[model samples]
Target: MYTIHFETLGCKLNQIETESIARFCADAGFGVTMAHSTASQAETAPVLSIVNTCTVTAKAEQKARRIIRMLLAKFPFSAVLVTGCYAQVEKAQIEQIDSRIVVVPGTAKDTLADFPQFFMDLLTKAGAPKTAEEAAALAKDLRAWQPLRQIPAEQTENRLKPNSKDTKAIESINKFRLATDSFMHHSRGSIKIQDGCSNRCAYCRICIARGESVSLAPAEVLKRVRDIESGGQTEVVLTGVNLTLYRGTLQTESGERKMDFADLLEYLLENTDTISFRISSLYPERVDDALCRIIAHKRVRPHFHLSVQSGSNAILKAMHRPYTAETVVAAVENLRKAKDNPFIACDIIAGFPGETDKDFEQTQELCRKCRFTYIHAFPFSPRPGTEAYTMKNQIPQRIAGERVKWLSDFACKSKTEYAKSFEGKTLKAVVEKRETNIGKAVTENFLHIYIEENKQTLKDLAGKEVSVLIKQALDISGKDEETEATAVLVCDGA
Candidate 1:
């Protein structure tokens, strides 16, 4: 089987989409591998490589470009397919990188499911291009084939129509069921229930790249959840660009009902048994009482991450965020009230245009008031076409870095304290890493705990939600990377 390697950069939504495409390829009889160190690999190089790009930060896009360049240089014979937010915004720049590259923007990511067939057809057509000239010609042809652009109506319609071959292909792809099934990349299953963001924040280009908000239908989401449960994946994360903005329709016994994110969660809880759900992230303004009530469900994991950009209303208003600092505090309060000691986290941009010293201090004060267990602090990087890009009084890079460091340190302290709270308590955890002697699992409240494997093979516990007794917490904070908030634990009854 031809090997296809995937590298994903960005959020859980991007990872879900990549896994979906990987499953499709695997179903099409292609060897799917997720790897980051392709340049150092000693095994046979893959015939094709797909890098799912992220445009969240300038650093993310830089890394994508670097990875793509490395992939092209190391595996000359492999053709590269780049897709996702970064590709959507900088298609021309990425396309100019190499002739072997094919750019598919984030908007057409759903079309990625049909890529395996495209790759198969390309291989069949090439039939072993032995010479450099033959390979170059093949690459040119591959680059010319824009999968999402300007397809003939008849061909598109015929492809969409139900047929024996089409049915078989769909079955094969869906056979994988859960996005993480037999996949080496992720331990927990992921379902992309929503995509694209409608909120046009001043500092964000994701809205431009992803376009308007769109959500998966409620029935389809429930079906995906059922599939994950049947596959023995006890923990599944519901991912999206803006999860709080999710809106869909569900056919109820009485009639068709419009459902929001909270309703969707409640529906899944009512329909499925034993499967725990995790919400990727939320907007502070949208965290209503209904959402908090649904979050109180036992099956729903007590971990929530919010996209709270800044704690200062001044900076927030400048960024065009709908919620105020007080809104975040209320949301956190509601969440805590709903679930005891829920692992509340938020994203914080330390420096934005026109942010005064008082504004920065307000952000720090908010973090202290909210007592977030985790804080994703980013030094604001101006992006082209963003309102903040041209906004005056841009914070200096040095000052921004310092603010980020302060938040990072605070986050480390908060996370370690939170982990300490769980010490000696037995909690349900989904196994994430299973080696020969040691296994790692994440608790419902998002603590990463490592346990010794005795009498049972660690591999057998992979993807299983097993009981673990937390022994102690460890602070593994770093400068470049966020602290993992890991702890050492013992398996229950071990």
Candidate 2:
């Protein structure tokens, strides 16, 4: 059997997409293996290797290129296919790195459901390989073949032109079809409810790479949830480029009704009984009262992550983020009022063009006032096509690095304080993994809990939600300081 090795990088959304592609490949009769799996262990080289890349930061893109080079070196005979934001934005550059590499842009990546057939057709065109020996010979020849340069006529046309009116209708119908297989084997599964983003943040290349926002149909979402449940997944994470922008129209027996993100949550809560849900990051301004009320539900995890780039209104305006510092404060207040002690996380950009020391101080003040449980501090990295790249008053790299260190240190301290507040309290947690003497779980408010228990006890609790008393919050941040601090959870009867 032909095997395909897959490597994925970037956000949870990228993970979701990679899972779908894996499922598609499996359905097409390819044996799927993790990228780290050795070819010697598999006893044969994979026919194809896929890398789903990310380009959120310069470091991320560098990592992707490094992985591509490593994969090429290890799997010399395998056809390397690259897709994702990096491929979408830097196709020419990636192609130059390895002319044999097949770079598929994000816009056409979804059409990878048709990739298996495409590959088979390519092999057939190169002399119709009918026997096993012929197939192996064809595969060897593919090492030198330039598939990307000689894409089929129909496939090339489809990528170039817009879909016809009839094709759009058919695509809309197909969008609601659910995949029979689960995306991930873990208890927590993520379904991408929305794709793309409309927000034109001055420093972001994601909008240009992902295109406009489009919400998945509610019916398809519910169907996928049921499918996941059937596949033994207990928790689900609804992810999107901009999750709050999810909008779909529902048709009931009575009449047609519109459903926003809030409506979708309520619908899922009212419909699905066994599964719990966690929402991905949302914009601060979109966290409305209605959405907050729905989030207060017991089945919904009380973790709210906001894309609050900076605390200073001046910096926010420069970044082109719509919300103000006041708006962020109000949003946090609203969530806190709706649910007690909800875990609030914020993304902060330390250095931006035209940002001053006073502006950074404003950010610190806002973080202090908001009392965020976790903070993702990133130093600004200018992308080539973004407006911020050309803007004046850019902070020096050394100064930006210092600011990031300061913000990150504060974030760790704040997280420790937040974890300390839950000490000695009983919280419900879902066991993520079970080991011989310890089990890892996460609480509703997104606290990582490590339980001390025997192998069988931990196994029994795996993939199930159970109550645990928080004994002590540990600072497990020694070598991997970037990792979160985990709390020690004592099993009630163990």
Local distance difference test, candidate 1: 0.77
Clashes of each: 0, 0
lDDT tens string, model 1, 343-425?
99999998898888899999999999999998999999887757777788989999999999999889988888998888778
lDDT, residue 356, model 1? 82
lDDT of 2 by residue, 1-494 (tens): 67778888898787777878888778877788754544234345667778999878898899898888877666665657888888876877887875447777655566676676666556446644344455345444553344443433322222211111111101111321223346433446888888777776778777656666788888878878888777776678998889888998887999888998999989988888778889889899988888888888888888889999899999999888988999999999999988889899989988898889999999999999998888888899887666776889999989888988888778778777888888888887777642422477777788876776665776777766777777777664333533233444454422
Whole-model lDDT values for every prediction? 0.77, 0.74
Off by over 4 Å in 2: 35-45, 117-181, 433-438, 456-462, 476-478, 481-494
Clashing pairs in 1: none
